[model samples]
Target: MSEVYAARRTRLREYCNAGGSAAALVSRPANVRYLAGAAPHGAVLLLGKTEDILVCGPSADRPSQERPDEALRVQTLPGAAGGDPAVAAADLAQGQGADSLAVEEHHLTVARHRALGSVAPRLRLAGLGGAVEQLRVVKDEEEISCMRIGAEIADQALGELLESILVGRTERHLALELERRLVDHGADGPAFPTSVATGPNAGRPGHRPTDRRVEEGDFLSVCLGATYRGYRCEIGRTFVIGTAPADWQIELYDLVFAAQRAGRESLVPGAACRDVDRAARQVLDSAGYTEGLTALTGHGVGLEIDEDPQLSPAAMGKLDACVPVTVEPGVHLPGRGGVRIDDTLVVRPEADGGPELLTITTKELLAL
Candidate 1:
């Protein structure tokens, strides 16, 4: 709704004003979508003192809103691949009497920043920093609902995969099929590239699918997520390829599962993010298998698959209610393969049933 966008922009405007800027140029697609409902390619949002405008290049696709938000005004630059939207936005800001404009330094490239300066020599540009990212960490009910549906779709796709035969299929085929299934189940697309690691690749975080064929007694790990209306959720599971798992496989699976459970249980309002990471890290550390652990047990998932509130040793933040994060504790042995378990959950107060588990698929070490 226009009112929703207007309220968000108002908050941003106040933030910019407090930072000594009368306008902010949002060049990051996610930030623009968060404030302007949609971000066509090469589009940027200019949060001015009086009006908000969405600036885009000539070749940019039009936003699909039949009736655009009244609070958002759209402006397209002339010529194909004409000019940078951020530069155009800066020019517009100067015309609108914006004395100082804040831009997302992390999102805007040095070249674009220079171009912006060149176009509006009098406009003072400041860094917006991570303001938009910070605002997105805490999820509203509507955003959470979209993520919930995405989690459900991912669960269904994984569940269907488990029921099918998997003796000699290549990793790429499985990954592609799972992606197709996600689309079939009402997903805009896969949140991120689907990962299907087998044998020595099992438990490898972000392992790209290869041509390796699934073997009879190998560890199979699959990590995938669905994007529903721009919200994303992730789910990962490791399974044994044969009728029964080896002794080493069972041991590693149990350890990772226990560690993952610890991480999940530590998610609560006011809990330090690093403390949550430690709870899971300690499990593998005590077992003398800490060398190959992922830097972070898990991370925040939202509009982008990996956003903020990182659950890592060096992280510095406290868990807040309504924040959704993934608790994925894993161990990857060099040539022997390993196990990883991941789940998406929302942090809530203990009285309200603690953290809500969005990925409901069984985490048991299943023998396929």
Candidate 2:
């Protein structure tokens, strides 16, 4: 497993050499894990030209192999307990004859950047800039496997909810129950906050779980996901309460469902990020519910819940194969309610079956 990390480091070293940097310091937790296999809390990775090192905080003694940190050279030489690992990584890079070091400016605070400069006066500091993030956009089979498992865990949790008596349950309680089920099914935790909006609160994007009890003739929308091995995926479903649904509720659910399908169908390799978002946004816009639309129709999922290639109007770049992203388009009408359908999928070419859906939870609106 360390060999896997060694190979990853070798590739990054090649990238650094090509970019004219002697070495690079990876301080972002996800990037550090990608390069070194394990990133202790507050640890930083120094990808020297020859040897790679994981510098841990002074007080950190326990290290786990969730992703296998043991594959890289470990250094528990933090200058002080809870001290900045980035500075120590910069010092190590300087000692290794690295004249120039690249750092993640977006992830590093200004104070830490200044400390690195002050600690290593001779070394030139450069921006690593989105290099690691770019590498992460197209995941390997191993990464997709983690996301697949996470999606399965989330589906199981949602499936169990369908069997229970949902009417009269508080939104907050249902959300918490789903999160607990995710953990019981072997997930690291919820990918994001579990959203359970009942009655008038339903269908809202990012709706915080409210205290409202489920009422008959109301829409119940739920969105949730689980994180496994640092990989995350999302799933959402909107349901009708009671034996029969109202005409307005059916119309809103169908519109949102179509928007979600459009977004999912647009998940092809080489599709523009904004174009995919537009595929869904247009449906809701023409329906006169465009006033409170969320900024993004969907976004990326991986080591972090929200990553690059944002499915928004202002986003740039085209989608690529092996990229795991979510397509969630939703609509929420104040005082009335709304509907949201979401799923995690991987962008694939037509030869390999267009887009591979990860979250397989039923999308058909069910009456509960």
Candidate 3:
């Protein structure tokens, strides 16, 4: 793992050198963690001409699991100025005689950017422009293994929820229970907020859990993920509450299942990201259920719940092998509930047995 982090930093250093910057400041927490093994609170990474350093604020606590790679030097700042490690990192880079430093413009606020410039008046500031994010698009086998474990944890959590009584349970109650289960099943934590939508709220992406209780024949949609070893994987499944699903419920579920399958099947290496989205979207579109569709069919997932190589109609780029992404597609009628089926899968070559599925929970519209 230390060698992996060192190699990642080496790649970033080469990128910075090619861009004419001798130093690079990584302020984004995720990017910092990608380069340094862990991202302490208020910590930043400085790839200086002399040496790479993980700069920590006074308040930052280096947990055993969150420690930076031993290959990188750690510098702790003192007092009020420690609140912003990027400024201290910039100052250190200037002292290291770096002529120019590249920083993540997207992650820095105007005030923070100004403070960095103020701290290193002589150093030329350049935009890193998602360079670190680009490097993170593809997953190494170790990273994929982490996500796979996370997916299994999520699957166990969801499977347990399905076995227990669900009727009369409020959406908020179910969501909270699922999160607790994720932790109980050995997850670092819930990857994101567990979403439990009941009745009319079902199938809505990013729906906040409400007080609505599960009722007979209501479409119960749930979206959840678990974070294991800093890697995240998502899984969503829709079920029918109480009684047998109505004809409309089965239709909607089948439609969404087909669409999700299409999206998953399109995840081969070298396939266009937009095309993957289209494959899923066209199914819903052809069914005359085009209106109110989500802006994206699916998106990449990893250290962050959402990452790169977004599977969207407007997304650019080709799918790369080992890139894990979700294929979630759904439909919801105005006052009536709908269905959603989502799964996390890793893109792979044809000879590699196609995309590798991480989440194994059944997508069948089970009645609870």
Candidate 4:
């Protein structure tokens, strides 16, 4: 594991050199983990000219976890336990003859940046932008494996919910039960908020669970995922409450299912993010049901629930092979419930079975 982390750091170091910065300070927790393999509290990875180092506060337990020790030297702050570790790192880089250092401006606060400038007046500060995030867009086999396991855990939890009695149960209770099942089956935690919406609330993305009781004929839409080793995956399904479904319910479900499939099938390497969203959006739009659609059809998922490579109308950028992303498209009518089907998939070259699907649950609309 440490070796893999070391290799990732080497790649990041190359990126730093290409940006004309002799050193870089990574502070974002996930970016720190990507480079150091473990991100202790108040820890920062500094890529120096002569030697790279992971600088942490005095409280940081050195090499206590899977953090890489072979690729970079570890340094601890002096005099205090919780001082800004970035300032200390920048001071050390200045002493080591570093002329310029790159920092993650998007993650770092304005005050922290000013503190670094005060400590190392000679060192030129550069914005690292999303270089680390750009490198993380492509998933290694290990990262993909974590997401696959998370998806499986989520699927198992959802499967158990189907076997039991759902009628008369409140949406909030069922959502909580599914979350407990996820942890019981082995998950780091919930990837995002567990959404269980019933009736008119169904198909709404990011819907908070409510006390709405399950009725005889209602559309119950659930969206949930699990996090395993910092990687996250999402799964969503829409089900009918009663033993039978209404014509409108079946039609809406089929339409959403088809749109979801189109979005999933569009997860090829080099496909534009907007193109994928358009593929799914067109289906619902043609049916005159495009009034209240979510902005994004899908988004990249890995260390974070929502990352780069957003799949939306105004989004730009071509997908690359090995990028793990989600494909979710739905509609929420004002007074009527809707349908949503979501899955996690990896963009892959056509030769290697383009777009590896991580979530393997069936897409067929089920009636309970």
- Model 4 steric clash pairs: none
Model 1, span 90-142: residue lDDT tens: 99899999889999999888988999999999999999999989988999899
Off by over 4 Å in 4: 58-70, 76-81
Error of 4 at 301 (Å): 0.8
| Count of steric clashes across candidates, in order | 0, 2, 0, 0
Per residue, candidate 3 scores C-alpha lDDT tens digits across 1-368 of: 79999999999999999999999999998899999999998899999999999999988875445668999999888866546788889999999999999999999999999999998999999999999999999999999999999999999999999999998999999999999999999998999999999999999889999999999989999999999888999999999987688999998899999999999998898999999999999999999998999988999999899999788889999999999999999998988978889899999998999999999998877988
What's the lDDT for all of these models? 0.91, 0.88, 0.93, 0.88
The weakest ten consecutive residues by lDDT in model 1 span 62-71
lDDT of 4 by residue, 1-368 (tens): 77887788788888888988888999997888788877777799887887778887888753342445566688778755568889988998898898999999999899999999999999999999999999899999999999999999999999999999998999999999999999999898799889999999999899999999988899999999998877889999999988889999998889999999899888888888899999999999999976788889999998889898899999989999999999999988767888888999999899998888888878888999
lDDT of 4 at 182: 93
Against the hidden reference, what TM-scores do the models get? Answer: 0.98, 0.95, 0.98, 0.94
Q: How far is candidate 3 from the true structure (C-alpha RMSD, Å)?
A: 1.0
Clashing pairs in 2: 38-69, 203-338
Clash count for candidate 1 is 0
- Model 3 residue 121 CA deviation (Å) reads 0.6
Can you rank all candidates by TM-score, best first?
3, 1, 2, 4
